[model samples]
Structure formats: C-alpha cells, structure tokens
Target: MHEPAHARVPAQPLIPAQQKVLRHSVRGQVLDALRAALVDGDLAPGEIYSGPALGERFGVSATPVREAMQQLALEGAVECLPNRGFRVLTRTARELAELAEVRALLEVPVMLRLARTVPVSAFESLRPAAAATAGAAAAGDLPRYADADRSFHGQVLALAGNDQLVQVAEELHRRAQWPLPGAARIRRADLIADAAEHSALLEALIARDLPVVESLVREHFAGNPA
Candidate 1:
C-alpha cells in the first residue's frame, strides 16, 4: 500500500526545538534512503544534489527531499545554499583527528565511569546494537552500520544518566562519522574490524572488567580507523 511515484507529498520546514529525528514518516523514509545513498558513495562527497532530481529518484515530490536535506544539513553532513542544492561537506585529516581527540577527552572517561557505576545487567539490554552493527558490516552497508554505531555509543553514554553528556557525545560522534576526504577509500574489511571493536567492548563491559573496558573504550576512540 504505497503511494504512486508521481505523488506530491507536501513537506513543512520544522523549527529547531520541534525538530525530531526523521523516522516512520514519508520524509523520514526519504531521509534514510538518501543517507544510504551518501554512505554508499552513490552521492559523491563535494557534489551537489538538486532537490527535484533527488525527489524523482525516490519517487516523491521535491518537498520531502528538501526536508531530508535540511536534516542532513543540521548533522553537518551537507551545506544548503540559497539558489543551489545542498553541497556535501568534506573534512580534513587534521579535523578528523581533532574530532577523535575531543571524543576521547569527553567520552572515554564518561564511558569508564558508567561501566563502573552501572551493573553489568544494565547493559544487557543494549546487545541489539552490537548485533545490528555486525549485520551491517557483513553486508557492507555503511549507512546502517553508522546508525547502529551511533546508537550503541549513545546508549552507553545514556547509561551514565546524563542527558547533557549524551547530547554532547552524540554531536561529536555524528561529526566524527562525517564522510571525510578519505572516507571513500575505506574498505569492507576496515568496517568489519570497526564492528568487531564494538563486540569486544561489549564483551568487556558485560564481564564487568572495568580495566579492560576502559582500555577498550580508549583504544576505540584513539583511532576510529574506520
């Protein structure tokens, strides 16, 4: 029961506070598909994607495409222009290194504290994220892998019971995942190794091996080699 390709589903711009992560809506579906395209390199970095063209590709009107692009803009994934469409933003090696440094400084200690404070059983509920990351890596699906990675880390920080800390971690994490200039060069094996880190970290957390967990967390961020 889907709408026709020519259907013109209208879209409305959302205010900052009202903005929710796109999910379960027509625009949200478009948003997910578009993100996959970006991650798969179907949409090259530094390239511009016109709203109408993208809409046609997704079999909708331009509204949802534009709406999704706007959301991507907020993620620091793209820059929207007045007369032109959105331009994919590129990052430098130094910038990516700095992002990792900031996350190491901000999140490593928080994860360690949470690991120590929360019971091992508290983290058992989050196993699905690790599973999802593994699945995505097996399929070489970068977009799904990124989403699951974000969810896994975000959940770990949320266990610390600090909304503000989670917010900061999420922002920095999203920026760290940006399609840097070297992103296209990453291989499936690299992503699989990345996924393995999550699994290893979770095993340490569940074992209540605080020292090992702390070391794993620090090592993971030391080089987001993915």
Candidate 2:
C-alpha cells in the first residue's frame, strides 16, 4: 500500500514554548523580525514604530519590542524619537556601494594575508561551513544561506589571526545584512552562484595562492548581478 501524498512529506519542527524562548531569546527574535520587516520595506524609513502595536503583531509585550528597538538603534538600523518612537533607517544605492567597497577593503587584504599563512588544518576547517552554505542555498532558505555566508567569511577572518579585523567584519556584516532583502530579489541567481564562489576561495586558500585568493575575494565582494 502506498502512503498518502501528504504523509510522504517531512514533518515540521515543533515549536514548544521552551524551545521558542531558547531559539528566539525573546529580544533577538523581536530584533530579527523587526529588522526583516524594515529591510523588506514593510516598515518604511522614517515611519514611527509603536511598541504596543509591534508587540501585538508579534503576540508579545512592549518590553521585548522596546528592547529590540534599542538594539536596532545601536546598529543604526533604526532611529529613536524622543516623544515619538523608532523609525526605520534607509540606505541609498551609493551608500550600499560604499559599504561593499569597505568590506572589500578590509576583507581582500585579510584574505590575502590568510592565504599565505593558512595551514591545511585551517583550510579544512572551512569545508564544513562551505558545505553548510551550499546546503542552505540548495534548500532555497535565503536567511539561512545568508547566515552561512557570514559564518564562512567569519571563519576566514578568524583564521587571519586578527581579533580586531574579526570584530570589524562582524559589525560590517551585520550592517550588510540590511541590504540583502532588495539585493536578494535583484540577484535571485546569486545564492546558488555565491556558493560556488565559496568553493573557489576555499580551494585557493588551500593551495596557498595569494593572487588567486585575492582575485576570488574581489569577485565575491563585487556583489551578484540580477
């Protein structure tokens, strides 16, 4: 006897209250949801966010919402109004281009430096992250794909042996996540193509080829074509 069509499908993960709290951390969940909302243009730039209103949307209370907003303000993703509330921050094309340029500036040199020094062990450490990124892309999970991308780049920065650069990369990477919503729509082919680039970078690093690694770094930071 054949199983029902729906029965053949994978079961969804259960979201128990304890698991929900663990996964979301209350504040991080609120922050990420609000950030996604802002980046997706659901909350237009300069639009005031009411804590109670936002809490209602998330089925929580204002405390978490306010905490999220304050975090966003620190990240420059939102602005706080004294008598009003929080407003989404907008970015222009030129501003985004500049941000990418900055990433290139910090990243390319570090990758080049790492390429010269990366041991076989360090290069091997990146294989899991690369595989995970490819898996996320294959699954068409944009957020997970992006997170894996961050992880891959972060491992590279950490391998460079510069704590300050690693910190800088983390901060910049967080800001870069803002542009991803529109960029993802524009470069729909990228998530797949970008996965391949990670492979090239990994191979170049393993080979200890500084020039090839630098070139690959430039290609990776150049952004994806729509």
For residues 1-226, what per-residue lDDT tens digits would candidate 1 score against the true structure?
A: 3212222222323223344544447688788776766655566667777788677666666788899999999888889977678777877788878988888888877777777778888788878888888888888777778788888898888888899998988878877776665455556787788888998888887777878887887778766644
Give the worst 10-residue stretch by lDDT in candidate 1: 3-12
| Total clashes in model 1, counting residue pairs 3 or more apart in sequence or in different chains | 0
Model 2, range 96-207, lDDT digits (tens) per residue?
6777789899898888877777687888888999998888778766666767888888987898777898888877776766653333342435677888888889999898
Q: lDDT score, residue 193, model 1?
A: 86
Error of 1 at 175 (Å): 2.0
Give all candidates' CA lDDT scores: 0.74, 0.70
What TM-score would you give candidate 2 relative to the actual structure? 0.81
If scored against the real structure, what TM-score would every candidate get?
Answer: 0.81, 0.81
